[model samples]
Target: MKKKLLVFLLIGVLVFSMAGCGNNAEKPKSDIKVAMVTDEGGVHDQSFNQSAWEGLKKAEKDFGIKVSYVESQQDADFAPNFETLLDAGNDLIWGIGYKLSDALLDAATNNPDQLYAIVDFSYGDKTPDNVVGVVFKAEQSSFLVGYIAGKMTETNKVGFVGGTAGDVIWGFDYGFQAGVQYAAKELGKEIEILNQYAESFSDVSKGKAIATQMYQQGADIIFHASGDTGNGVIEAAKEQDKWAIGVDRDQNYLAPDNVLTSAMKRVDVGVYNVVKDLVEDNFPGGQTVVYGLEEGAVGIAPTSDKHVPKEILEEVKELEKKIIDGEIEVPYNEETFKEFMKTL
Candidate 1:
């Protein structure tokens, strides 16, 4: 009887342990796995790549989905990194930059069933049925900052450092120049702008050298649309006790006193919305999503340094409203920019 009782108790403990194990086992994996492929800038670029990654992280938390990313060190890495993510069972893959257009297009064409998205590029009539292109009105926000830079310049000379000479970056350049020209007309002051392209987003030394030369040439404020290279621009500004404008993200936190403001491009919002749509089964494929000031996806960062006058800030706010209301048309390219300059 004693042996039987002991055996029965052991069996009961064993069954309970088995039940607990079954209950604690991880739930079946989430069906929706999303992944991102970063451009040569890498994920911590503190600009474009960082913003996109933040969106992926948000989707992972909000939807209980699986997410991953691969950082491409150079142009050659794009296709392989994309394929790796797909092979790893990602339901959606995002390429974060205009440079990835060809690779992404090829991949989407070959794998017609896989969903893909690319930032800063649009195929227009050639858009694939399974791909969505995300673009931004970067010029609109750059114009705002350019106006501020014009008003704040002590020397009446400002500078712009662009990462690359492309339609996307050109939008920033033209909008900035137009804004400066408008501000010059308003203030009845002669403003000069010195513009240069670093030709590389990752070359910090090149950015710093270009900015330093501009500053030496009497430019009191400089704006950079370079990626990680902008870091060097900010450093040069701080060292020289000058002002700098940032791009893509609000970078005033980097040097609150030195950074006048940032031209904001809400890349994170774009990425988040794309993933949310995918998860919710309403993915808007075969279309280009253009986010602009009206959509609150682009704007100028708040002036946190107290260098910009209250009246000037108010004026900028009014201009923002005008742009959003379609009362003010910001130029997006060189030709329109020149025409806009003529009007000013």
Candidate 2:
């Protein structure tokens, strides 16, 4: 009887240990998997792609979702990158930037039931039900930056640079011009404004060339809507002993002394919001999600040790308050741009 009882206890221990191992294995299988497709700008461009990646990472932490990504080497590869992630069994796929719009539209059409979200682009009329278009009201923030640059420039001349002249990016350039115009008109000052586009988003040399020319022409402060190319802007600013404003991210850290401020696009917030909705089964589809000053989606970064003037800072703060209160409206699109110009 003693031998039989000892054998029985050993069998119980083995069974209990196996059951514990089974539970541990099952726990990992329950994790949700999310994935992303980056634009040709690539992940480390330190701009839009980087911001989107940061947001997706946040979702992974908040919801315990498994995250993965594929970088697109060029515009031609956008669709392939999207499809590759989808084929890998990603629960939802994110497409970063407007350059991926055509590819996303094509992929959404083919996959019909596939879940995806896009940042910075949209289908004007017929958006896919499974795709969410995340966009931002950059004009609102650009206006504030323009105000600061116009007010702070010692030369009374400011310039704007863009990666390309597309309607999407040009929106930032025009809005910036409007903002500078507004500050100039309101303050009863004649600030010379120069604007140029490099037509290439990744060419640092070209960006630097354009910025140097603008600076030589009397622009003491320059704001750029360029991507990695904007790195060139900072480089040029430092070389020339002038100041440049950054964009999309806190690029002030990139050039501490030369960077005055940055026009933020808040891409990370958009990414986090979309993924959160997806996890909660509240994915907003067939709609354009707009992030603006009111949503805290766009703003100017704080003045660095570069130490912007107190008066300029105060004026910008007041204008920001007015914008948030709906007392001052910023414009989007080309047609409304004319009206925005009148206000400036």
Candidate 3:
């Protein structure tokens, strides 16, 4: 019996030694690192760029990846930042905002072997095999807010302030206008909408001045798509004790009483998804990712009950459903959108 026990103990020791050796023989996973380039609005602007940064930070936490970022001081820095990130041996480079599209395209083309992703814009003709484009259907949420404003307006007057004049900014403008018109027609209400563009995203003073003018013109609810510049619009609304809608992330908390609802663009979700894909070895390159109502990437922030009426809340819920169910179509271009506005 003693001899048998000794033989069993020897066999167990040999098995443990072989298993430990095999474990050490396996190769470690490659380290994945990502970097982001912010547009004109610096990081922590509490808007679009901030949201994207938050997403990247989350990816860093989840994947154990080294993350770095550079805020572009001027437009010229976009290409240089991309070059610096690639040259630094980053596994992926992310460009935030539509303003960087041209630069991103140039850099991505020059560095064909480097993987790149961008938000808010895409390559005009064809995307390179290593480049991924991310865009949001901001109209989904903008439409809901338009419906709410049209219903809640006492003077039949609403306003939309855009950050720029182009397809990118107009996408929000046209969508909001269409939503207002749709609700006005169906609800048998009369609401007038005033639309204007600030021509830039960083000038908060200009946004404030424009918003103040709209209020003087009898606009009770004004929606500003400008970045930090929109904060000035909110300030104007607060000073006047009127309502202002926020864009990209919830600004309702920024001014609880004055902010009605936010048109959420889910920029963070876009950044997180791309990083996750790269980490999981499912990189979605050479593809344009469109996040819309169905994906929960673009929609309206929940209305803080402190400001909005219950009826308005119910109306927004119904509109969200229709948008998701495909019963309502929001117009997205100037000409077609202008015709739709006539119905309001």
Candidate 4:
């Protein structure tokens, strides 16, 4: 009996050791130490910053690599925050927003040996050899949610609120407009769409103010591409019992009943892909990779089923397939939108 008991104990210890071998927290699985620097919205904004962090965390878990991040309280903190991360000897550093374009560029230029990746910003021809830019087709996701709003709105008046008037935000702006146009045209009726820009991404109060004005103007459904500021739009929707669409991440949890759905941009995938490639020594540096609908980089939140109808979801899938199949080209800006509208 004693001999058998000792053998069982040994077997249990061997099994446990084997199971925990790769994930032994005391011993990192990879030599790559990764880090991230958040935008002014910080790491907890539950949007781009948060999504990017989730991706890095996932990479750290899968590869047993060390990951860390520093939040920027304001625009002035961008350069210094990046400097702090770079000084920490991180093998890879990620910047969470386009607001870090200049600082990231300067860092990459100054330290050509250091590797870097920026989410939501494409450096175009100015891309550095040591850096990679990860961008998404945000317009594709925004248009689907807009279609939902157009079909569901009983008032026939919808609204759009933007964080800033840049090329990035314009994708959300014009895509939503085009979607609403498409739906209204198909319905053989006119749907009034209102638009506004907060000019800042951090001001929640300003977002609320703009959304309140839109709601008072008889618009029932409002979609926002504002970062942290969009929280205010959701709040206004809850207060007025209207519908507000979220962005970047699934924000339905912020106001379950009030938020119709969210346009989910897979920022995590972009962050993870870069880290994974680096770990495998197949790093795609000095390149701009675009993740769009076909790549599963952008789509509506799964939680949409809670509010959006099945037929509408099916319609979204069909339209999404068309977009992915190249049968439908979703516009990214005003000029393209004008040309696209002429085709319809």
lDDT of 4 by residue, 1-344 (tens): 99999999999999999879856643344667999999878788878889999999999899889999999988899899889988999988898888898899999999999999999898988799899999999999998998899999999999999987988899998888888888988898899999999987888999999999999999999999988888899999999999999999999999999999999999999999998888877789889999999899899998999999999999999999999888878888999899878977
Overall lDDT per candidate, in order of appearance: 0.90, 0.83, 0.85, 0.91
TM-score of every candidate relative to the true structure: 0.90, 0.88, 0.88, 0.91
The lowest-lDDT stretch of 10 consecutive residues in candidate 1 is 22-31
Evaluated against the true structure, the overall lDDT of model 2 is 0.83
Ranking by TM-score: 4, 1, 3, 2
lDDT of 3 by residue, 127-241 (tens): 8888999998887788888877877787889999998788778888988888888878877867889988998787889999999999999999999898878988999999998
Q: Which ten residues in a row have the lowest lDDT in candidate 3?
A: 22-31
> Could you give candidate 2's per-residue lDDT for residues 176-227 as a string of tens digits?
8777877888779899888888876787898899899999999999999888
Best by lDDT: 4
Clashing pairs in 1: none
Stretches > 4 Å off in candidate 1? 1-29, 303-306
* lDDT rank order: 4, 1, 3, 2
| Stronger candidate by TM-score (2 vs 4) | 4
Better of 1 and 2 by TM-score: 1
> What global local distance difference test value does model 4 have?
0.91
